[model samples]
Target: MDQTTAIIDLDLPGPRISRHVYGHFAEHLGRCIYGGFFVGEDSDVPNERGIRTDVVEALRALSIPNLRWPGGCFADDYHWRDGIGPRDQRPRMVNSHWGDVVEDNSFGTHEFMDLCELLGTDAYISGNVGSGSVAEMSEWIEYLTRADDSPMADLRRRNGRDEPWKVPFFGIGNEAWGCGGNLRVEQFASLARQYSTYVRNHAGNEVYRIAAGASDADLHWTEVLMQSFDALDRAEEADAPAGPFQAVSLHYYTMTGPWADKGSATEFSEDEWYLALERAGYMDQLLTRHGQVMDRYDPHRRVGLVVDEWGTWWNVEPGTNPGFLYQQNTLRDALVASVHLDAFHRHAERVVMANIAQTVNVLQAMLLTDPESGALVRTPSYHVFEMNTGHHDADSLDVHLQGVPTRTGEKSELPLVSASASTRGGTALVSLTNLDAQAGRTVVLDLRGRDVVGHSARVLSAPGLATHNTPEAPDAVAPVTLDAVRPHDRGLEVTLPAHSYVTVSLTLA
Candidate 1:
């Protein structure tokens, strides 16, 4: 076993790791919407007003803070009106982006809000800018949030909901550099400023407007957005229509292979494992670099950085529609999630929110639903989320590592371990991941500034990298109570298995 030591100074707590950092994304692609999260009320699957009941029950365990809706690329094409009135009379449109299948507009604005309520999560609406107008985007907000007797509110009443819903986060556009219109940074920044002007706050519901930002390593996009923001005269615009955008978004996905031939999700060699970890670890550099540019414009870190889209994107499973982006989740994917989330926790001050690429039946998904049998399977990534729930809304405690092992990949190097720590009222949660595929790790917790009285841990591991859960054996990669944790003179000592993730709950004295 490899040995390492990490120290956490409870007196030196950093920023509050926003629960929003643990958010999820659900787009109108593949089984994600139609068969994964929603099956019609008439279907055999148990549902609440067409929203999947079993799926909600499972996700609720994670205390899901927020959910991003409408699109990734689909948001720019979605027209909220088409989904409102009557479902049977709704227009049918080609998804175009995902599988070229017809979107019956069955799961529209109302259904989405219903899903959020069922999951007890905040709503994050990504508006259309590629193919939509400012008036359309403005009125959609009014229709969902204006509680008074207005044209849009009255239309909403006629559509059945008398009271408006709450929309907390709003995205101006999604990926304008690509599917969201293929626009230049200057053009999108100007559009973001203009369109965001009309996304009004209604009935005291304040929407955190997030402008579409760069993909991987595009620091120029961040520069342009901050430059545009620097031009705004906030002092004079104190109570402006829709206050200046509160945040800018970034999208980064970890892929083991190149885009044209992204490798398999479950089938991979040992070398591929270290490559994925190295790629995932690159998010730290992306956050730090972009944050430096933003700091030059806004030194106080007032504006937030939202990683609205991120996860591992792999090739579609065999016989699956390529456009749908359906892939299997395994131990490797779970570790990828841990790496990204640990990065998010470390940069909590600047990264205000993050949404994994998807929540169900899509890339790096949490749950997979069987279209034919209506069976629900929880992915290993789901267990990671559930296990890390203790970190939500908790103050981040920096972990100082010493003598950590490293593995060199084909193009990059990766530390064999990744970790983050946080504390709530009287308890502290230490999350650790061992990236080595064939070596166990003995980690010593050098607790400082706080006395640890008791500790218990659970480990999420599998016999191999490809271990995953199917409906036949749902607990294939589930967490088990770790029996190797013991109390040391300074704090706790944990024995982590190879290619495993562990969370230790400590009772602070």
Candidate 2:
């Protein structure tokens, strides 16, 4: 059997992988907001201000950095004022984007901020630029952050919140070219600049304004957004004042099939598995290519690349709402998550933040909540995030693959081994994913420039690729201690089983 090797240079650490890179996205779509995260203050399920307690507890385990809210397509059409004031007095609207269900405006700004507080995560608020006015977007920011005797601030106090809430990240718009407004890249660039100008910082609460960017291979959208920035446009803590925007957003989803026919989430063939992984690996290419374009404009890497929407998008489950985008999470989804995270680490210098699409009961979600049964099940993807919490705020280490094996796909080939490493304080965490489905492989960690005194490892795998968790069998695919680790003179050796994700924590000297 061929052996895979990953060479890690302990002394040559890369950029600080921002904890924000591990961010999550929650949109007011499908069960994500109503049944998933917010079970209502009156729900039988335990909740804190309508925020699901179990869901918050599950996400808190990952120490989720930031959460993008009220978005995807909903951000463009949503009016913040309708969601504020009294819950009963709040207006009702139709969520045309997802399931076409009537939105009671129950889960609005206050509820979302409360949810963020409960989870100890930052808020990434996406404003409505498509259907709303510049004044509306401006007032929303002011209402959330203004603390002094201002009109918006006074209104906020009357509404309930006496003190202002810090909005760390604010999005000017969502996908301006598509569901956002169907505007051209050039048109959206102008609108983004206009809309972001009003998203101001109030009372020292600095907001990181992120403009809507591209998806997949739309490099032109990135170029236009980058070119729109001038010397005055910069993030907080820069030499100049916070300008038009601090970052440009990107949206990507891994699907083996096409848009009209996204492949099944649970039932899939071997070819589909390899194809799905290969698609997830494409995030690296998107980052590198977009970074090249961004570098031409801002060589200092001032503007960050925020992938706010990402994850596996499969067809909806049988008999479910087609527009709801509800799907099951499996071991394959876990591998896909690991692959994209590894890519984010590889481009840590440019990719500052990322949020997997839909936090609960949506695409590639962390928890699946069945309110009917009152059961909250953690998906396999959740375990991967929980195990990788150590990588947050750590310095990314350079990982070089040598003698890596490959699996032949129908049209392309994929590397059987994928890995990334990081160091925080004195401990280094190495993440490895073996994509092989039927065979296990031996991998050697060639640690250089550091003395490893002690090491521990954990592995996540299941008997089959389609293995998933339900309320009845929540532990079907979960992380377990890998006893096959051995200490070598160089570093540590791990025996990775088929279709598994492993993390080895090394105490460095």
Candidate closest to the true structure, highest lDDT: 1
Full-model lDDT for every candidate: 0.92, 0.91
Tens digits of lDDT, candidate 1, 52-160? 9999999999999999999899998899999989899999889999989899999999999999989999999999999999999999999999999999999999999
The deviation in Å at residue 462 for candidate 2 is: 0.4
TM-score of candidate 1 against the unseen true structure: 0.97
Per-residue CA lDDT of model 2 for 76-129, tens digit only, reads 989999999999999999999998889999889999999999999999999998
Off by over 4 Å in 1: 230-243
lDDT of 1 at 317: 95
Estimated TM-score for each candidate: 0.97, 0.98
Query: In candidate 2, which residue ranges exceed 4 Å CA deviation?
Result: 232-242
- Name the lDDT of candidate 1: 0.92
Q: In candidate 1, which residue pairs clash?
A: 71-75
Please state every model's RMSD to the true fold in angstroms: 1.9, 1.8
Give candidate 2's whole-model lDDT.
0.91
